[model samples]
Each structure stands twice: as structure tokens, then as C-alpha cells.
Target: MGSLSRHWPRIAVTLIPLVFALLHATGALHLGVLQRLDDIIYDARLRATMPRTLDERIVIVDIDEKSLDEIGHWPWGRNRVAEMVDELFDRQQASVLGFDVVFAEADESSGLKRLRQLAQAELKDQPGFVERLNQMQASLDYDALLAKSLQKRPVVLGYYFTGETQAKGVLPAPVMRRSELQGRPIRFIGWSGYGANIEQLATQAPMAGFFNPVVDSDGVLRAIPLLSEYKGEYYEALSLAMYRLLVGLPEVAPGFPREKFFGSRSYGGLESVLLRHPKGTVAIPVDDKVSSLVPFRGAGGVSGGSYRYVSAADVIGRRLPPGSLKDKIILVGTTAQGLLDLRATPVGEAYPGVEAHANVISGLLDGKVLFRPDYAVGYDAVVLLLAGLTLAFTLPLLSATRAVLASAAVIAALVSLNVYLYSAEGLVLPLAAALVMCITAFALNMSYGYFVESRSKRELANLFGTYVPPELVDEMVKDPEAYSMKAANKELTVMFCDMRGFTKMSERMEPTQLQELLNAVFNRLTDIISSNRGTIDKYMGDCVMAFWGAPVDIPHHAPLAVKAAIEMAGAVRQINEEHRAKGIPEIGIGIGLNTGTMCVGDMGSENRRAYTVIGDAVNLGSRLEGLSKAYGVEIVASETTRKQAPDFAWQELDRVRVKGKEQAVAIYRPLAPAAGLERPLLDELKAWGAFLRAYRAQDWEQSDVLMLNLQRMNAKKYLYELYSERVASMRLLPFDPEWDGATNFETK
Candidate 1:
């Protein structure tokens, strides 16, 4: 609970994108950019996966520029079109033939109507002219000739639906009636008017279909409605008609989803269009509008090579060998630019509209049509939920590198799943929401971590950076909430290091020189203190105060403080050596260390605040520094500090009562690490220990013997000499039973 409260801000920022994504998925908000990106993704996937190889089963008889130039312009005399149809059926042996062009009006290029008018008015007196016109009418009526050629043949005529209410010519029989839908409220592409074949040709080829494609908002013709409604009748597309003719003209019916899978409620759409034949039923999947995405084979046009292109002039002029198009499904359409048959498609911007129909026909025969099922919206919601929530909760907890990798993996999984459905199951599912949500979540999470959370860290660094080592600051920033300036009681080690003989050095040197020298000396001592993870409390003129285990916790703080004091003393020694080389006055430092419970935090007046420690232990530490001069040692440590640092060898200086305290406390001076103690020092320490025991026991003779031996070992050592004089003074007095052997200091 505490951790969550601490990191709530970061987690909330990570969820911002997720909230927007959920709104988009649930239709509460619409993101047009995501839609556009989805379209691009779908187009690219379609283009990349298209089969560019030739489909020989479907062929396009292109009415290109060559055909127009060789056989005059389009809407050529119906007699010429009749002759071309005869050549394809009688000579080429095509199994099924369909026209992508509509014969909406009668062909009058034979001049038979003008001749009839002349016989009626201008040449009424010429009886022989009227009779000759009647005889040639049968041969000149081009519409009749084309109708005769189309009869009793496997032919499917093409037409188009329009949004305008003015119908022209006559529409063919609808594949399905409104009564067949059983009031399911399926939404079919609706049209109010149409341009179909004239009655004369319609009777000959009554079976026909509309070729109206569904253009997307981006003006790309990627799908075609297999069934469009006009006056309560559902008509089929040209591609669907051709496929039906090739498969024995199966009966069409509405295909509803099974109730077990989609529940009993209305799905608001048709699942598929079923083609029922004697053998089996073929199901063609449809989207909400009863449309199917055209599976483009590849780029379009004659040079595209996805479908074989035969020029109409060649077939009409008998340029190809007979039976060459045997068993091939031929579609007659124009690819000439003047015909305005080019369309924008996924694979090509200027794709032949005829090739789109051809590709649909090919896909229908192979059962590879793509569609979005009714549950696609639900699928999108589920995906977005999973992806968004996963990133929202997990990204805030992960490191930067892991978060990036996790976000990448989620995006890859979404893309792979979407592509697999498209390729293997022919399902066109929504992916943009999930992908955008993941990327946005990761970016937002990282940004918040860097900007907002890092601002908190920077503030922490600014507050305590000067008082503690940068390494300790780094540790503190990892969980900045865990640290603060609020005062709290904690067991810590405090240090007070005072420079000795600073007054004498100041008197002998220039003010600037003295300042420079002091700064140099303090800089060295501060470095030593910081290197050992000590938090410097303050510097009081000739003294520097530091501690361990505040703002950040250190379990072995006592040892660290002791270690830093020893190093500080050594630094002062080195500085004094440099002073000696330069003929400057030598200096010294006295360090005191104590470990106990103290109040540690940012403390002081509002105008001048500092992160420092205060308590009895801190005061005792200061008094220990003063006692270091009396003991003639560079470092002094309280008994509590000595007890914590067992690895260091210590010499007990005295048990003394300072000015403020009535209770006496034991103090010791650190010599060196226990492992590094020399044989002579160890022997002297042994002798000094015996002297302390004898002096405390008031055995003057024994104390004298031990002190003489200690002085002989190190005659010039001040601590041994001071203890000798103390024992002499005490020996002159009577052996008093009330004496506790604790020395007292009247002043600090």
C-alpha cells in the first residue's frame, strides 16, 4: 500500500494513453489518425502478400487503344460485337463469358433507322425502296444480331447501380428477395437507380449482375458489394455472377450466423451469401454492408502479369488460334484511358476497374475473400483492453531498458496476430487501437518518469547533495519518497574533527595565505570524510563536523565514522608534511567519534538551515574532540564507538567527566587496524593496560613498574608520559576508598 501511494503519480501518467484508447475502442471518442494508420497498414499488408503470378483461369479481353484504333471507337456496330461474340464461343471455346460493359441503349450505327425514316417520309413514293429496306432490316438491325448471338450461351452481362432516382433501361432478375431475409435488418448497399441492358438484349441474357464497387473515404476501391439492394431486391456483383455461371448457376440465399456462436439476438448484418447447388453449399463471407474485400492478385494492367490480357481486336480479327481460350473465363472490358475504367486500388493507384472484377472473380473461385466479421468490434475492444492495461501497470515498475523491450514485444505480437488472421483465416481485424495504445503508454510512462519523477530526484539532490557523498545521494534518489528532511531519532555515528595549532599558524602567515592554507587542508579532510560515506554536518571555524547514517541508512555506520576519522587525521599529517617542505608552520587535527541515538535531519533557523545531527551523543562527540588534545592523541573515540568497531585496536585513554556531565564515560584512542598493529606497539599497549589496572587499583609500585616499562618502550610518547604524571600526583594522595578512578574536566 505504501509503495503504491508513493508511485501513484507515475502509474497515473502511464494510464493516460490507455484511457484515451479505451474511449476510442468503445466509440466514446473517435481517433481519425488511428483509422488512417489502419488503412495504411491494411494496404501495405495487402500489397506485400498479393500473389503476383498469373491466374490463367480468368482472362481479361482488354478493349485497349489498339482495339479502338483497329476496330473504330467503342460502342461499335452491334453486328461487329455479335461477330466477336460468335468468334469467342464458336472458335475460342471459352467456358463462360461476361461483359464489364453495359449495353444500355440500342446500337444504331448500321443506319437502318435513317433508312426507315426516309422510306416513311422523304421516299414515300418509292415503293421499291421501302421493300428493299424491309429485306435489309433483318441484317441491319444490329441490336437484334447481338441479341441473337447472346442467346443460348453461357453469358453474364454487367451493369451498374446509381444513387440518383432516375432508372434507365431494365434491371435483371434479383438474386435474393427482401422476403428471404426474414426481417433480419441486414444492411446492404442500397441504390435508387441503375443503368442496365435494354429489353432487346436483356431477354437474350437475362442473367446479369451489377459491377458497382464500394469506394472508401480515402477514395480507394478495395472492396466490392457482392449484394446491393434496389427496390427491396438484392442483386449480385459481376464477379459473383461470373463465378456462379462457372459453377452451374447455383441458387443464392442469405447466410445467417449460427445462434450457438453469436447468441439469439440480431447481429445487425449478414454473415455470408450461400450458394446452394446439388453437390454442396459454398459460403461467401461478407462484412456489415454485405461486402467483401477484393483480394488483389497484384498490380493491374496488361503488363502486370497477374491476369492474362487478350486484346479484343485480336479475338474479333481472328488473330489467335482456335480453342486457345478453351475452358477460360473471359471478361470483356476496356483498359483505354478514354473509357474512364481506371480506379484507385491498394496495389496500384491507377488500376483497371476490369482487373478488380477479375481479381474478385479469381478470389471467389478460390474462396480467399477477406471480410470483417460482426465480432470484429468486440475483438478490437478486447485487444485494446489487454494491451493497454498490461502496459499501464507493468511499465511503471520496469526499468527503462525493460520497458522498451516489453512495449516492442507487445506491438510485435499485435501485428503478428493481425497478420496471421488476415493471411490464414481471411479475417480483417482492427489493430490500430492496440498498437497505438501500447506505444503511447510506453512513451507517456517514460516521459513522466524522466520529467516528473526526475524533477523530484533533482530536488533531492539539490537539498542534500552538499552534505553527503554523491554516491549516497544516488542511493537516496532511487526511492526519494523514503527520505526527507523531517527530524527523526536514529542511532547514528557523529564525527567532529578540529585542526590543532591553527591559532599559531594564522599569526605567522598572511591572511590570504592562511585562508588558502585552511581551505586546502579542509578540502583534503572533506574528501576523506566523503569517500567513507560520511554526511558532513557542518564546519565550525577550525573544525569540521560529519556523521554517518542520516538521509540514507548505513548499518555499519560506527565503523565507517571511525574509519573516516582515521583517514582525516592521516590527511592532516600529509598536509603538514607539505607545509614542512615549504618552510610553513605544520598543523594537526583532532577527531572525535561517538555512536548513539541522535536526532538527525535538516536543522537550523529558516534563514540558514543545514542537514545535521543533535543530541547527547553529538555533544559528547564534541567534548571528545577537546579531550583528544589533553590525551596528546590525534583521534579519540567514545566507548560506544569502540564497542561497535571491534576490528580496530584501541588504547583506553581515560574515564572522565566533562563540564556538563556528571556521569563519567570511557574514551579510547584508535592506534591502527588490529591486523596492522606492529610487535612493538602491541607490547607497549600490553604494558599500558597493566599500568591502567595498577593505577586504578591504587598500587603505586606496580603502576610505577608498568609506566617505566611503557616509557622505556616509547619514552617520547605523550600519552604514556601524561599517564605517568597523573599516577605520581594520585600516589602522593592517600589511597581513598571513595575514589572511582575517574578523572574530571572542569572546562571544555
Candidate 2:
């Protein structure tokens, strides 16, 4: 089951494309599916047009929700609509007007019929009779009045057709009728009769066409059926006929050059309609099947709004001004509830039916329409394969970061090419497919990277000794590349601090109390070290081994080490106070510091490893701690560490050779030399230093004179006894030529 589930994606890959091809080839493309494709195209194209700020020539007069409630239902009387037309042509001076609505019926109400009945003397008081007469006269079915109005100027009417058996409209003559269907009687369905105004309207304004929508499978209108054939006849759409008539071009077929059809000069399916503007005939490419792709510019039409709609109910009253219908072409239609013209579209859901026609006309005017040809499919297949294969092959070979960057690069490349084709060549490639493929490859690679790295992290962190610090586990994961189990020379200040006489203290306390007390002390000391940016190397029983400047850089390593030593001593004092309060024995701490090159890294055998500092410097630091008690101090450092930390006051102890090193080096006790008189104490130390040198040279008179004067000046002196004892011992040992001031201590 697991294997089948894993391979299910491949099975789907093989089946889906075959299904897509079958649907396309079988002529099952419907209004619903085509709409979905149109929506996808709209989503991408609209993103491209986001940056445009202004367009100058187009203007939109809104017929908003305000106008709808101001009026009642749609399809008002024709005389009032004629007034609106006069207003636009005469007052607004609009160069041309195209009607998005259709006039399938006519209005015939005139004021004279209602006026006659109300004037009779007897009927005035009879309320019921007067009401019936008003209703009768108010309903003057005037196809004649509207026809006379149409004669005043150019006007176009709109209509539509259905391919079903219940389709309406008389068959118009087919333009490209072939003799191949010879002797086969063709049946045509059409409108049996039209409330057509022939004398006044049709004679003056002769252009008319259908407005049937070519919907896709998703109920989206992506194209217009430019020409429909039935019973050896053809008819035009409403927008096409009006456009053809206004341009004064041949309506049967627009004269497009044959080369335009072969090359890039595209055209719609209808006859070549010369643009009324200076632009010559537009090439509209209708497939051999008599359908044309509607080149939709976008949702925003003239003045960035759709068509201007005047409510029919509002026009019936004098709501619109005079001269409303002067020279404009008025096509009238309905926009009432229950009329059911609303369609779901990308830009809007409640879009009026007539607005779709307006969008087409606007596209025609702006030349912003993007049409798809049958040839685009073949071109896109090659593009998708190239884009997909490139990412799939490259992703596995690169690191996670590089793979992400490459994926973005591929997406950007595909988008740039798509946009370039749109602007330069008027061709739109299938960009979404390539983007999907790039994302797929990137996702796969990153998922695999995470899976592989997760195991490595657990393995690497576990390799650290079981008792090692948990913090080291995280550092190993963040960068396993820089870490090496082998040691390397690193300059650091290593600290080895231990508690004095811990075994005696532990023996007196209970096991739980001892454990708890140790935890409390260690936790406090460790926190102090970390706060100073010192990496705790390891903990050995009650002792701590820490260092500065490893796995990360700490610039003031010497000062930090000195400060940590002081804080640990203070903590020991606090811990001893707590022990006294609890009636337990007190504990003291000793800290030693050394500065030199040390071997630092994760060190140990395969079973146990530690990130620590080790070398002669580490050994010296541990050795220095043993000498602290003899010097009557808590913190001590070798000469190298003392010199590095010049800010601290110190008392120089005698030169000492540690257990491991034969070379004798000076050591110092880290102590506050003078609380209020630093210069005085410093002067005394310098004089004592002079005296010590004299005594070493066997000049007893000068040594005795300098010590007596220092003692008299500094009465509370702490190092005075040490100097006196050193002088007494030197005199007793006598004057050997090999004598060096090397002192050895045995107590902690």
C-alpha cells in the first residue's frame, strides 16, 4: 500500500494530459469550461496592467445604484430614450455613441391619447372609470414613435441566436457557403417576426446585429460568435454590424489582406470593418469554424469603468435633461430583476448583460485586445517542457539556498518571457504551467534536504559525550561544517576554579543536601561565566573548566576571565554565609587563570567528546590554583595572564615552576591592592620590589632599610609579612649562585 501510494502521483501524471487532449479534440468545449480558461487568463493579464495610471480619451457616465432606485423597472418608453440621445449628441458633443443594449420591442405612448379622455365633463368625478381610461391611453404601443425618432440620426439594434432546436431568428444569407452540402436540405431557425420599425427607424439607421455570447465550460464568456450559419445563411453579431456600419466598410466581409491572415496582422471573423477613426481596417481572425476569439482588453473600459446605463424608468419621466437624444445611437434593453442577465466574471459577478458588449467595443477602440489563436497550443508545449526539464535537472545538484534561488530565477524568467510575448509579439504563452513545474521541483528538493539533514543533526549531537553541555548540541547543528573533532591551536584564557576542602564538607552533609547544595553553587557559578561570554569547557566533579574565545569570538577575553574569577569568589562568600546560617561548614573557592595558545575544539575518543581548551596553558591554570592558598589569596594568575589584564590591582607572588613545566615564571594574586589610596600602595609595592631585588643580591642593609620605611608608612599593610618572611628565609638558605626565587606550595 505504501509503494502504491508513493507511485500514485506518476499514475496521475500519465492520465491527466490524455484527458485534456481528448476533451480538446472531441469538440466538447462548452460555454462553462471556456469561461474557466478565460478567468485564468484574466487573473494573469490583469496583474500586468496594475501599473497604468491614467488614460485620457475615454469618458464614462455612471448609471449607478443611485440611478436604479430613482427609477423603477427597465425598458422605458422610446420617446424619453430619444430625449437622452439628443442630450449626449447635442450637449456633451460625444463624437460617437455605441449602444450596449438591444431593442427587441418598441414603445408607442404619446400625450394626446391620455389628454382626450380626462377632458370629458361627466367622467371627471367617476374615479374608477377615469382610472381605467388613464391605464388604456397610457399604454400607447408606439413602435411608430420610436421609428420616427431613429430617423433623426444613426442608431443600431442588438439581438442574439441559439443553436438548440428552440432557437429563434430568420436565417440570413451565408457568406462562405460551400457546395459540399449540395442537395442536402438545411433547416434554419430564426425569429419569426421582429417589432422592426422599417419606415422611420430602419431606413435612417440600417445597421443591426446579434449579441449572442460564446461561453466556455465555466459559464464564462471568452469569445463572441461573430457569424452563425444555418440553412445556407450567415448573420452578424450586434457589435460587429454596428461597427461595420459606422465605419462605412463592406459589411458582408471586411477586406483584410491575405498576408495579414498568414502572418501577424490579426483580424476578427466579421467582415473587415474600417475603423471610423484614422486606424485602417482591423484584422479579426475567425477560425474556419466561423467563431472569433473576443480580444478582451480587461475589466476596466472607457474611463476605467464599464458602460453608462440610464435606467429606463428614469427616462420615462423628465429625469434626464432636454437634447438628451440628439445625434447619438441609442440601443435600448432591460436591466430589471428577474430578467436574468447577470453573469459570474472575474472582475465582477453582478455585471449587466449589456456591459459585455461595451467591453468589446472599448477593446476595439483602445486596441488593447489580446486574442488567442489555435497555433498557441503547439508553441506552449515546447516552452513548458524546456522550463520544467531545466529546473528538474538542476535542483538536485545544488544546495538548499541555491535551489531556492534557482527556482525563483526560473519563475522570473518564465514570467518575463510571457510578458515580453504579450507586449512585443501579441502572443501569450502558457506561463502558469511552467511556474507550477518550477515550484514542484523546488519543493521536492527542499523536502528531501530537510529529511536528510534531520538525521545528520541527531547523529552529530549524540556523538557529544552523554554528560556534555546541551548548548554544544545546538551549536553543532547550526554549523557542522566548521567543527572538527581534532584539536587546533587557539589563543584563549583558560580558567580552572575549584572549591577548597569539598570532601570534608560533603561527608558532614546528608546525600540529598550535599547534592542540592552542589547544584545551587554550580548553577550560580556557571551562569556568571556564561554572562561574561565565557564558554564552559566542561565540569569535573565540583571543579569548572571554562575559557574565552572559542566556537565564537570574545574580544576582551582577559578582562572577562578576571571578572568571572572575582564574581565566583563573591558567590563563594555568599554560599558560605548561607552554610553558616544553616549551621553547616563553610566552603571557599580558588580560581586560576593562564593566557597562551591552547589546543581547543571538540576533543575526546569516539565514545565521548568535549568542546574544550587544552594545552600547557590549561595545565598552568590548574597548577596556579594550588598555589593560591599559600599566597593567602582567592584568585591567582600566571605572569602572562596578569600582564594581559593591566586594569586589575595585583600583589606579585614568588616565581614558581608548576608540576609539569620546568621553566620558572612569576605569578600574582588578583586582589584589590588599595581601596582609597591606590597611588600610595603602588609606591610602596614599587619600593618593596626594589628591596626584594637588593635582598636577592645579598645587600641586607638596603633591603632592611626599604622594608622598615614601607612598614612605617603603610601601617595596615597585607604583603609586609610575606616580604619579611621571604627575607628571613633567603638569609637562612644563603647565598648559592644557582638560587632562583621559585616557591613550591603543597596546600590547597
66-152: candidate 2 lDDT, tens digit per residue: 445664345545655565555555554444454445455334345544455564665677767666665655345354445555555
* Model 2 alpha-carbon miss at residue 597, Å: 65
Best by TM-score: 1
Which digits, one per residue and each the tens of the lDDT, describe model 1 over residues 1-748? 5666677787788778878877886679999888888888899999899989999998899899999999999888889889889999999999899999999988888899899899999998986999888889999999999999999999999999999987878888889999999988888989989999999999999889898899997889989999999999999999999999989889999999755332323476788999999999999989989999999998899999899999999999999999999989999998899999899998888899989999889999888989888777677877887887778777777889999999999899899999998999998888887887888788778877453367877898998888888999888887788988999999999988898788998888899988998898888888888899988888889889999988789989988888888878877788778888989888877888899999988788979998889999999999999989898999889999999998899999989998789999999998778876899989888888888889889999999998889889988999888888888888899989888779999888
User: Could you estimate the TM-score for every candidate?
Assistant: 0.60, 0.44
Off-target runs (Cα >4 Å) in candidate 2 are 1-38, 47-72, 82-99, 105-141, 166-204, 251-280, 285-338, 441-748
lDDT of all predictions, in order shown? 0.88, 0.60
How does residue 80 of candidate 2 score in lDDT? 51
Question: How many residue pairs clash (N, CA or C atoms closer than 3 angstroms) in each of the candidate models, in the order given?
Answer: 0, 47
RMSD for all candidates, in order, please.
Answer: 36.2, 32.0
What TM-score does candidate 2 reach? 0.44
